[model samples]
Target: MRIRIVLTFILLATGLLGCTEQRATVAVPQTAQASFSWFEYQGSDPVFAEPLAPDQYQNPVVAGFFPDPSITRRGDDYYMAVSSFTYTPGVPILHSRDLVNWQLIGHALTRESQLDVSGARGSRGIFAPTLRYHDGVFYMITTLIDNGGNFFVTATDPAGPWSDPVWLPELDGIDPDIFFDDDGRVYIAHNGPPPGEPLYEGHRAIWLWEFDPKLQKVKASSGRIIVNGGVDLSKQPIWIEAPHLYKINDWYYLLCAEGGTADEHSEVVFRTRSLDQAFEPYEGNPILTQRDLDPSRPDPITTAGHADIVQTPDGEWWAIFLATRAYDQRFYNTGREAFLLPVSWQDDWPTILPAGETVTYRPVRPAGLDNHPVLEPLTGNFTWRDEFNQPALNFHWSLLRDFARQWLKIANDKLQVQPQAGRLSSLEPVSFIGRRQQHMHYRASTALTLSASGLSAGITALQSEAYHYYLGVRRSSNGTTIFLEQADGEGVDIIASEQLSVSGDTEIGLAIEGDKDKVRFFYQLDGETWLPLGGSFDGKLLSTQVAGGFVGTMLGLHSRLEKQDI
Candidate 1:
């Protein structure tokens, strides 16, 4: 199984679609008597894979919304970063020592000027990134599809005040990687048009240019097409992207992802003795793949490509790549998650997950590596509770994108979201902060106080830009009420609701229970008593199978107003 916590988000304006929704009034106290502790759901089956034997561990070294991982080692310390898409903190930087454990360090792109993805669609902001350390400086080169095309940011420290992006308008495509040769020469490679197009279907090539660090641009006269149409000219592979250059011994090896980012995704390699000579394709192409595996294997992981290789201090090599864990056969809502696999090199060519073998949950730990501190569960199961008592939310929490303006704050032991006029499904940022759903069977709840009429705050199971379910409390001049709403292609539908006699300072509890098959919504006035608010809804509606995107489900607190605008 693949574990991912993702935040490729897109927001919409509230109430703009003019869909009629049901409303109800309820009575609740203004203050919560006690805070409820986060509890795991008790089910017949285990929520997580059993922990590995003391000597062994799990794949998905980093879980949740962490994908397209590019890793670099700096003196026994390993630093990795992943794609964040349209999320405000574009590239999430993580630090690890053992490769099995990782911690969030900081983002490489935090400023709107550095990387502005405001109003960009989900999964359209940032693509793959290549993180490398040369001398004392750290360099991250990536493509911001929504802003400028290709750019690189530099920081002396991995936990960084990353420099503003140095855009390379000369680099014509995405998935860019920088390679520094031993002879004091720097090169940049990317998936771009061959000198001319229109050769055949799926016609794409890997282009390279000599990069001058002092000038922060590509040397125009040094451009060359390295590999055209992938490994086999007769096969015609599509989307030969995500290029990485590695020089071993005397050969320069070119590694890239071919096919697409779907089930057919695979990694292919090529090598050459000289920089400008014709590169020879590996006789055994597609160094990594899962497309040929049996479809009926239980809890299969498909789309296993777009991989990056890293070498440890002990001479052990591992490949970090993106894959999906489908729930109930072909439905996966977790997006593409980072998976770890050991790499074995024989005669200068590397292979992943041996012939006739698929990705496994418990891979033997690399030899001679000391284990790092385990801060979170590797099985993607845990109890998380936030009372909003801190000055700022934890780094683990994420917002959809940088809002047009600030609309929320943390104060008075609660997260106060501005009452903007809109629905929870609005395109513009209303008021939302969320975390990814790491398990199929889990419980999520929140306690809140609503002070004004026409304001609502509660929990949501957000799948994408146009699909989600909301369990919220709406206040009106008459009384307060709790309601359950679902947003589908037909627009918003109020499935069920209940009225309560609530006034100022009243507190109410909302909860969501999700299983592999369906989800149930509930609310409570007394902390111990939960009243079901709606019938079980089809859980597959929120699955990527039905939602169709690169984002997983985000569960979080959201508030909307009926007559206010931000």
Candidate 2:
């Protein structure tokens, strides 16, 4: 909801809009500006809660497109990191005391020098990242799909200025995981091509290599194929990825995701007593999956796999994995989200979520721990707003590609963004910054003063490189106009347009109201009255299923210089 203010349009005289190679600060009306509302965003909506039990919590421990969750614990503190894929400052590092509650502390990849995602499309940059803490340093190893093959960064503190990529050009695979054995030996486990030619199309193998931490490279002579053709070669599982090694007692457990990370994704486990020997498949493989669950079940969580397990201080066990909640049996606009489930050992093998249970909306809290109040981002309900008063944007906010220095600035109690030379569809980084949608039904609005003569700026529900919806306020010879633009693979199309009376000191409000079915665009001169600018557009256009990507919808502010050269 917007604050209702009825004030005269007063154009403060300034040459802020026409300056080049410099920044111009503009003053906003005192009544029109308000401090940004603060709220903790979790999952697709505000976190779901039960009034009866304050200790109980919901699935999606970390929400909104946070996938391939890898967690580790240091004493009472717990840290989890997820794949950020093409977003700048990739691999979000979240911290928490209890696993149910989490907050974005920092990012492992902050500098552009650490990641090169020049022309990479959606879902093509970073894959699943394995976060491990060994000795006094935090290690994060991941695949830069199209950029470089594999690399790892290290830092003493989880919230870090992590070191640059120690590129493993010799490693030829994705979803890399690192293991530091007790005997001062380090190893890297990942899915790669078979020893020679594959028997079938998706016939991949899990390979292991001895890693030298001092040199930060793989030992060439120590390479070996651990698990070939997945669990059962006859059944032939596909895309064995996201491998993690764990040593318990005298057994080394290797867990990896198979069945292609789609609806059929499942976690399969293998164990071996020695690294030199091949790992044997567990009799009860696929310890976690929902594809075999009853289809008639309500709000089923599909695509459940890519799991990583962590033990609590109290000796309790838990598994953190990725799953997607489908709406109306088939539609799922919220991308894969992180889910937590308890793990119980039976006959030396781990079982997840019991025999017939899928992911629960509200699960029981871990035993023996005090019923502490729910924390931020997991506290469940509040509205989020940013005043942009701080020197830097919040850790949760990310740009499409590398951070552009000239794109945005904080000054004069307003977020000043210089219009960039490209549209949201272009591969180049534009003047856009956004957080994930995180909600099926919500309202996001921003107040902007379009000072430039030909500049247009507003909010967008960005789905991918070729698919998105733009609700922008434009200034031209015809005065201020609200335009609704849609960009599919075909091209950009203006679906609706409306003229506004406001001229200078253009305090126009633009909002995108979203529901499961559609998204509607609106504009307001006075915050009280909103005029619908475009017809309700189909929400499916932004879904991962329809958009064909590994990313979810991002709703945020964007600006463009209509005539600037790219």
Candidate 3:
């Protein structure tokens, strides 16, 4: 009788406890997409961390062509601006909360009324802009490469309806930086050829001047030579530009990026007690460098300079500098990306990476973190497939010239592209389908089924107007054949021609592989085994230095004919 009563009591208690445990263990599903994976060299299929994810690191967190980054923190918000370098809408403004994530809000220059960059080269647009917020107004100062010298623009909102450019008629130099002192005085620092000479022939010096905020100009009499490399060649005697000013405690610090922004680039820091005095070189100059990283591996981080310092909300200090990561050890993909380094105050000066090394692995997050923001992913996993219902082109696509509406349309879940009545060289032809190179060794394949009445439809690797590499099928006099062409700086011509028996409404796929020096081409018909078309092509034909445009070399799609039918 006692055992039977105990069994009923035990059964009821066990059922109640099981329900409680189930409720406690269950978790709500996350609404957002999957978190980005971090870059681990040891992982078998390593994935890159999100652009600015909360759980993982956000790298090059700022997107696009943000070269020569200048950042500042006001309260909880961070504002940054970068060199636009010949792009039409210039000096893009970005906002961020944590250093790892950023978003582009607006452009400082919209109308070309004040400055025109119609014919500017790739790296010759707006140079080194300094962003500052003071007295309820935000100020951005930069230099226009081809037009007026240094200019300033102001706005109340970080995402701006910015005021027109205030040209500083007296300031004459490039890579201009503005420093607003604690006492309400504004100073402009720049580099130029000595008073009556040119900068391209030889090296130059740094100049400082007091700027008038109301007049929107530099007081002509205020110009003075702060540092002259001609006086001491031991200062490296090379290009010393992008001077940034920061006041730490009682001393004023002037830091600059040295070298020609190539493999030999470095970061140099100097300081003084007064703005008028010559900056004393730091005993441990070049606090950060990658010159000695590896003897076998090409230095991964080249052009590591143009640093901007910001203090976090928790009182931690950090420096954001520009560095380039080469994808193929020859072709640069991360074109001047922003890298963050923690700074510590020692001996009344700022010390970064006290180990005197560059960080390749992601660092640990800062402490006292309750809430972290999620970062957007930069890589779009979509490939050559087109389900063309969207009204606009994808982010991966861009035209060589201004895009036209008539040449392309989307309907019936297919992208309909009409062949223009001109050659591929004509600007009006609108032969455009291009994507940025994400990896050097990866193969790019597209299945293009042409419905046009013409004989040419295929893919091409475009360098510029005079230099390109293309492998495509066309209806020649002999039959349909896949032709390979390479254009040096001289002219475009057939390199290796092979005749094929392929007919109408067929699928074409092309693959390009190799480093920047040598590119190989391959093709497959109807998803068959790929046949090697061309090997070890000269990569000089696809270089931005030789191409003369604001865009990098792009892999493009085209439909063309040698002569149009009457």
Candidate 4:
């Protein structure tokens, strides 16, 4: 085996193409190669995997980078949608009969006409979405920040050919939620600027508008500021956003997320008897927050807010909120995850969690629901393996801001991903596909066959363009070498590399493990023992706190041209 420095660039590998996908239009080197025989991801978090009573369930009903969750119910069936940011196939739609075991149905935004995030940053595309079902129609209202403003898509079925976006140019704000009153009234609520001069930085208000379902537009001259500066103005609340409205009995309830989406993040509520009346703040505001707890608490869950509440057919109320579980306090790489909590009603007021109370990691299952068969485990310690045998990609896989073209092919039960010039950091969408890093103590591995003239192709743990870790293998004229590459705000750097004695095309295995703050990278050849390619590195670099993005870490196969400049 000849030893040599490995200078290789990694590209983003995507999921297998559908049967009708056209040929890829992107140019690639003739010798480029990235084919995976199998990919597997497993998680073993004791806190989540602990034995639970049949009446109990995991807190994070939907895990990983799925954030700003909004749920809607259609009789006994429940459907959910979450923010996908810059990834194509934007809002993932999940379905559940019991609301505890959810299954991926499809995406709400699949076509370029529905979601165009081109030239947007990794964390800058799709914002909070409010999914609602009324009168046999499903509506998903959301904000597409940079390219477009607010919009709504409609579909008869949530697992959809969701209609092209009906852009809401008149609306101004994020997390646009639609509410239908029993009195044949339609309203829209969102987070945006106050009526006049701002009181302070992050001083925002909740605005309400009467929307016309028939005309598909906001009623002219019907917009008004409903809540200013959150629950209180003199108290000086910051970043009051993600407003969700509900009406229980005669009182109209308004829920909003406050205090910027960090440790200070929280959920608050207000109530009024009618829309014409002013909403009064709850006497005990900030129904949910984790900032007051000690930072030294073990396996702390922080940034708990952004809730959307729904009622079951049995008259039970449950709230689905976004929160972060950090191995170390305030630092989490898995991003904001969807948590489940029962909403307790107190004297005609709905409360999720009391102030200063820690969010529970495990909660009793919703009572009066039948024992729905487990389709698959969304929470707890579970292993998911994909053999590339299916004709179409699994809904779990994600594609970053790219059109659904033929960037990948599945033949002989192997996923073959062509190489691309653009690295993951480029403003242009790279040809990459990855799954959200769901667990802090999980391992992701894949087995791929590298060509004799091997191009760069391997595992990547990506948070954003500026912050990502790439474990790639390439074959130079000297020999084959595996390297661990990382990029931060500063730039990309090769941290570790090892030359292999393999002379020809070989099946190589790559793996990455994230244990709290520490992350390790590894690679192996011909089913041999996995050898460490890099030392245990700080995993916080891949977290939202460090990366400064709303997205979580993605762990899966990513590839790039072997000749691209660092």
What global local distance difference test value does model 4 have? 0.84
1 versus 2: better TM-score goes to: 2
lDDT accuracy of residue 84 in candidate 4 = 94
Best by TM-score: 4
Those runs of model 4 whose alpha carbons end farther than 4 Å from true positions after fitting are 1-31, 452-454, 564-566
Looking at candidate 3, the ten consecutive residues that score lowest on lDDT are: 36-45
Q: Could you tell me the TM-score of candidate 3?
A: 0.71
lDDT per residue as tens, model 1, 1-566: 11111222221332233333333323323332122222122222252457667777666666555777888889888888888777767788888888877878778987778987755656578889999999899999999985799999999998889999999999888899999999989999999985576377667889999999888889999988898878886787888989999888798988899998777888888999999798898888788888888878887878788888888878888888887777666676556778888888888888876655788767788777898875644345567667677886666666776634356666677676655444445445556667767666778888877766656777888876567887877666656777777876445677777888766666788888887668999887876899888678978878776767667777877776642210
Cα RMSD for candidates in order? 5.7, 8.0, 19.9, 5.3
What shift in Å separates residue 19 of candidate 3 from its native position after superposition? Answer: 80
The residue ranges of model 3 lying beyond 4 angstroms of the native Cα positions read: 1-65, 103-115, 135-137, 155-164, 195-202, 230-232, 327-334, 354-356, 366-375, 379-438, 441-485, 494-566
Question: 1 or 3, which is superior by lDDT?
Answer: 1
TM-score of each: 0.89, 0.90, 0.71, 0.93
> Model 2, 268-380: lDDT tens per residue?
89988999887999888788888788766776778889999999878888999998877666566777889888898887778775545678878898776554443346334
Displacement of residue 143 (Cα, Å) in model 2 is 1.1
State the local distance difference test value for candidate 2. Answer: 0.76
CA displacement after TM-score superposition, residue 52 of candidate 4 (Å): 0.7
Point out the worst 10-residue segment of candidate 4 by lDDT: 12-21
Among these predictions, the greatest lDDT belongs to: 4
